[model samples]
Target: MTATMMTPAQLARFEARLLAERADAEERLAEFDGVMTEVRIARTDATADDEHDPEGPTMTQEWSQRSAVLADVRAELADVDRAIARIANGSYGVCTNCGKRITVARLDARPTAELCIDCARQAR
Candidate 1:
C-alpha cells in the first residue's frame, strides 16, 4: 500500500518534539544519576542499617527502583536519538517493519515509534 509522506513542516515539528523529548530524558537520567550516587553513599554509611531498619524501603530497594527508571529513561533517549537519525536520513514517519507510512496521529503521540500501529499491535 502506498503511504503519504510527511511534509517538510510536519517533519520539522516532529523533529522539534523529538529533540525536546531527548532533552527531558537526559534530564531525568541526570537526576537519576545524582540520586544513585546519594544512595550509594548512604549504603556505605556506618550508622545506617537500611537492611534491618524496618522504617522504610531499604537502600537496595531504592537503588533497584531508581535503576529501573534510569534504564527506562536511557531507552527513551536512545529511541529519540534514533528518531532524529531517521529524520536526518529522510526516513521519519515511515514504518521500518512494513515500509508503510505511519499515521500522523501516531507520530504525534509517539514521535520515536518505528512501526506503524498495525505492525506494532501485531508485534505484541
Candidate 2:
C-alpha cells in the first residue's frame, strides 16, 4: 500500500500534539481519581438514615463512567508513549504493518497511530 511521508515539520507538530494529549490524559485521570475518592468517602460516611441516599447511587454511577473514561485515556497515553519512542528511534510515521511512511494528515488526526489508513482499515 502506498503511504504518504511526513516532513520534519509535520513530525514536530505530531510530537507537540502527543505531548499535549498526554498532559490532558494525565489531568483527566487525576480528576477521575479525585471523583472516585469522593465516592468512597460518601459511601463510608453513609449511615442508617443516609442508607437510601440518592447521592450515593449517583456518585457510584458517575464513578463507573469515570472509570471507563480513565481506561480509555490510559490506553491513549500508552499509545502516545509508544509513538514518542518511535520518534526517538527514527521510525516515527512509519506504518508498523507495511513499513510505509504514514501520512501527515492521518498523524495529525491520530498522532499515536502505528499504521497507515489502508492497513488500519483492513485490520478493522
Best by lDDT: 1
Candidate 2 to truth, TM = 0.80
TM-score of each: 0.87, 0.80
Candidate 1 C-alpha lDDT tens digits along 1-124: 4434888899999999999888999988888889898888777772365545553466568778888988899999999999999999888888999999999999888889999999999999
- Candidate 2 lDDT for residue 31: 83
| Candidate 2 residue-wise lDDT at 118 | 96
Find the candidate with the highest TM-score and give its number.
Answer: 1
lDDT of each: 0.86, 0.81
